[model samples]
Target: MQASQASSRLGQSRTSIGTPAAPRAERFRLTGPSVRLDPRIYAVRKDIADIALADRVFAPHYAEAEQARVAVPSVALREGPSDDARAVSQLLFGEGFAVIDSEGGWAWGYGLHDHYVGYLPAAVLGDMGAEPDHVVRAASALVFADADIKSPVVATLPMGSRFAATAEGAFLRAENGFIHSRHAGAIAAAEQDVVAVAERLLGQPYRWGGRGGDGVDCSGLVQTAFALCGLAVPRDTDQQAEAIGEEIADGAALRRGDLIFFPGHVGLMADGETLVHANAHWMAVVREPLADVIARLQPEHEKPVLSRRRVLP
Candidate 1:
C-alpha cells in the first residue's frame, strides 16, 4: 500500500504526546530476507556483504550502508515497514536518514535529527548532500520557483525544514525554490523568544506524531518552538523530562521558557502564571493560567507537577 493511503487508514487522531506507541516488539516481526532484530535497534538487509560495522548500532544483521534525504514536505515515520503501522513521528523536508534496511517501497532507518528509528516510504527519500544553510522560521512558508512574489508557489515548507540557500536579490535561492528572505534564517541563528515562536501555532490543531503547523502534540510543540531557536530536545515527554535543562526545585520559581511536566503531558511556561501547550483538552494550542491547569489535572493525575526544568537557563 502507498504511504498516504496507509496513513488515512490508520487515522490521524489526537493522541497523548507524552506516551509513545507500544514497543516495536509488540507490533510486528521482521521475516523473509529481513532478519528479526529489535526495531529500536537499527538493522539492514541480511544479504548485504560490504557493510560498515563501526557504529555500535550496526551489527551482523544491522549495517550502515545506504543514506537518504527527505524529499517531501513531511513523511511519516511508522512503527513497521507497512503504511498500516502507527506513525511514531514525522520527517520534514530536507532531513537526512541512514537507511539500514528496505522492504519494497519502505525504508527502515534512523532519523539524523533525534536519532529516531522508524520506517518511511522509500520513494520520499533521495541521495544525501551538503547540510542545509537555513531553516524555515515561519509556521509555513511558500516557496516560489522564481524571485517574483507573483510567481507560482512550487512548494510549502513547514517550520523547521532546512535547505541550502544563498541571497538572491530579495529572496534566498533554495534547492527546490526561491524563499522570501524574511521567512527564513541562518541555521546557526541564536535562540530567540520561544514563547513568541510557540504563539504562532496558537490555533493549530493537536495531532499525534505531528511536529509542524498542520498538527502538533505537546512535546512536539515544545520541540518545534525550541528547534527554531537552534536548541535540540528529545521527541517524547519521558525522555524530555529526564534529558532537558536544569531542574527547578520549586514550581513557584518557574518562569518563561521553563518546561512543566505532568503525569503524561508537558507545557511551556509562557510566564510565571501562563502555560502554553498543544493540549487534547483544548484540541488545539492554547494558553491558560498555570494554576487552573494544575488544579484541573491534579484530580486525575494525582500530582500537579512532575518536574520543572529551565531550558533557557
Candidate 2:
C-alpha cells in the first residue's frame, strides 16, 4: 500500500504459515515512507517494485512476485547479481522466494521465510513444490541417491532446511534423494530450547551473512537458533534488537536464552554469565564469559551492552 494510504490499514494484520501475526500496515510504516523504505527487506528499485508496495511507493512499473523455491542445498543472496558481490544472506533448500524480477541469470526477490531481499542466481530457484513436511534436525543431513547407507550422496542439507518426504523403512524418500529418517523430523516439531540448538553449531566457521551449519554470523546464529525452535524473527541484528522479546533494565540479571545486544552485534546468553555467538574474534561459533565479551568489545563500541532481552518464558 502507498505510504499515505497505509495508515488506514494499520489495524489489519496477517500471519504467514507457522508464524505469528504481523500487521501489514505496520510493516509498510516501518519500511514504506518514500525515503524510509529499506531495500534490504522491500523489493523496490528505481524502475520497478513488488506490486504489494505500489500503494506506498512510486515506480514506473510494479510487478507481481512469482513464487519459487530454493532448489539447491543453499544459495547465496548477494548484494548484486554477480558471484563477486557481497552475500547478504542465504536461501536454503525448499525455502520460498518471491521472484519480483530476474535478469542476466540472477533472480531479485525476497526470501519468503525471512523477507530478506537480494539477488540469488536464477539457477538456484525452481518451481514451488508441495509444502515442506520435514526439516533436517542434525547439523547437516546428507541426501543420498538411495535409502542404502552406502548410496551416493546427492546433497548436503543444512540444519533447518525443510522438504517434503515419505517414510521408507529407515529413510525418508524425497523427490531428489533419500534422507536418513533419524536426521529429520516433522516440520511442525519445535525444540524447547533455542540455546541448545545454537550450541549444536559450536565450532562452526563464522562468515558474514552466512546462516547455515557450514558458516554463520552473530545474527544469523540467533535467527537460525530461533528458527529451529519454530520461532520466526527478523534476519538482521538491528531488527532483532527492536522486534524481539521485551527489554530488561540495563543491569538486569540475565538467564539462559536471553539475547544480549551489542552495537552491530548480538549473542545468546548460555547462562547468567556466559555468552554464545558466532564471532569474528574467534572466527567461529564459541562460548565465552559475558564479562570477557564486554571487555573485548568495550574499546571499539563504547557501550558494553545495547539491550538485553528475554525471549523464552
Best by the TM-score measure:
2
TM-score result, candidate 1: 0.81
Give the backbone clash total of model 1: 1
State residue 186's C-alpha deviation in candidate 1, in Å. 0.9
Tens digit of per-residue lDDT, candidate 1, span 1-313:
1111111111121112123433321111222242344344334334321133222222233233466899888888888888799987888888888776677888877788786778888999988877788888888889998999999999998888889999999899987889998888888884589999998888899888888837888988888888888888878888799888988875357788989999888999898889999999988999999999989987888677889988786
TM-score for all models, in order of appearance: 0.81, 0.88
Q: What is the lDDT of candidate 1?
A: 0.75
At residue 207, what lDDT does model 2 achieve? 90
Clashing pairs in 1: 44-100
